[model samples]
Target: MVQPNPPVLEVSGLSMHFTSGRGKKKTTLKAVDQVSFSIGHAETFGLVGESGCGKTTCGRTIIRLYNPTAGKIMVKGRDLSGKLNKEERRFLTDNVAMIFQDPIESLNPRMTIEEIVGEGLTVKGKMNRAEVRRRVYETLDKVGLTQEHATRYPHEFSGGQRQRVGIARALINQPSLIIADEPVSALDVSIQAQVINLLNDLKRDLGLSILFIAHDLSVVKYFSDKIGVMYFGKMVELAEGEELYKNPMHPYTRSLLSAVPRPNPLTERFRVRVNYDPEAEHDYTSEQPRMAQLSPGHFVWCSPSEQQRYESMMRQ
Candidate 1:
């Protein structure tokens, strides 16, 4: 069932750096540095990291919300940097959709559900009003929304219902890939499960390629087929979701895994968090670290010596 032919989303050496302050006081902050990865067709690739580590920036940049300072972003083998005609540009927008973190802020409060979800349909001029209405109602139904809710404004719905509208909006275009940036992070715990399950079901039914971004490792592991762990604007580790959890080679990755809360009361009470201090943990002065593959699908960002250290640890 693993189709590794063409990647739905591919990014290479992507970097986004910003400068703050004025003149002499200006300091350059590298938000995303030389990140590279690809999501195969229908595969859910999870990007997990702490806040300000550039996970959201990466997602936005991929969707062309923020232009990249360097590197390439290819959607379905078409490079965005190339001269895109009207059709190609339209193709890009239609194929790639994003589910924002905060549903309330993402959805226009003034717009009714029908207008919001059917917004994408406006881009392609083929559908008539009746057809658009039918499509909207059907799509709303797909997201567990009733047709009766279409006339209501965003403010009328609960948090979870608002998110369903967002998802409906994204799916209206029949996008080949979806970048869900902390989609469930803002919802209540019970509501979060409902949204997560909805996404899971949609992926199964629609064969969606999802770039699921989140700060929670447990959620990432549950939803992702593969995962890439970010640290200080760099991809420190990438592997199969279960593989990464079972065998976290990078110090930062191991530290993150240690922090994921366990269900058992005894385990939670005695769990010790492994802190990660970049300065103390790595000495990149001599030779800069790069992403090195330890196994077929496992990659860790480390110097040559550190790579060997991880390999040795895996052997034991």
Candidate 2:
């Protein structure tokens, strides 16, 4: 199968590190190390990994919320690196938006829903009050919220409703790309489904591209066209959603898939267990783990021995 053209959001050699402690005792923690991937226009690219694996930091870095220690972030063919001039920054803001993890914490308690949704427009100063109100109502309706709900504070709504409000705020600007940083992680299971469905509907209706970041593989499988697995700040595997789940490469990806609960008791009982020796430390100086193409559009970054085994297996 032929792969598509260059993606709308192309990240190459993205790296982020932070220094901790003071003076002579300082140590650098490589939060995100040489991660690279791309999301096609109107595509949902999922990032799945355990907590503290730097998935969130990767998302923030892609949007330039945190300056990358090294690497390039290209959105719609525009480089968003270094300090931007005022006009350039404004243009970037209008083009990209983020849906934070916690809607309650992200939304202001003092502000009304209308004010919160209109905040982006107010800051951009591109539309008048009447125009902003019209756009806000239109966005609210698009996310399944009513104009009446707009007058109330965020606290007035339930968790799912609050999330809808957050989505409305992100969509009000008509951004081409959105980074949904675990948008449904905080909600109840039922509410989670509702929010996911709402996001799907919005994505289809608005023709927006998204990076859906979450640890839940099942959710990622349902929502994403392509999935990338991160481990210890490095992207170890990336493939189509079904292909990755059906034939996972890399030890870490296999281990993650093994943990996903099976519906059948027999299958669950027979599932393979992954054992990683905690005493064994990660070695980063070796070769930088170049990605080996397993098949069309499927890639894995593994050691030479593992890559040989995987290649042999695929040939069979």
**Clashing residue pairs found in predicted model 2:** none
Among the numbered candidates, top TM-score falls to: 1
Each prediction's Cα lDDT score? 0.92, 0.87
Instruction: Quote the positional error of residue 278 for candidate 1 in Å.
Output: 0.9
Residues 1-316 of candidate 1: C-alpha lDDT, one tens digit per residue: 3244668988999998888999899999999999999999889999999999999999988887777889888888878754567877787898999999999999988889999999899758889999999999999999999999999999999999999999999999899999999999999999999999999999999999999999988899999999999988999999999899999999899899898887889779998999988899999999889999999999999999999999999989
User: How would you encode candidate 2's per-residue C-alpha lDDT over 158-209 as one tens digit per residue?
Assistant: 9999999999998888988899999999999999999999899888988899
- List the candidate 2 regions with Cα displacement exceeding 4 Å: 1-6, 277-288
Q: How well does candidate 1 score on lDDT at residue 206?
A: 96
On the 0 to 100 scale, the lDDT of residue 140 in model 2 is 91
Model 1, global lDDT: 0.92
Which one is best on lDDT? 1
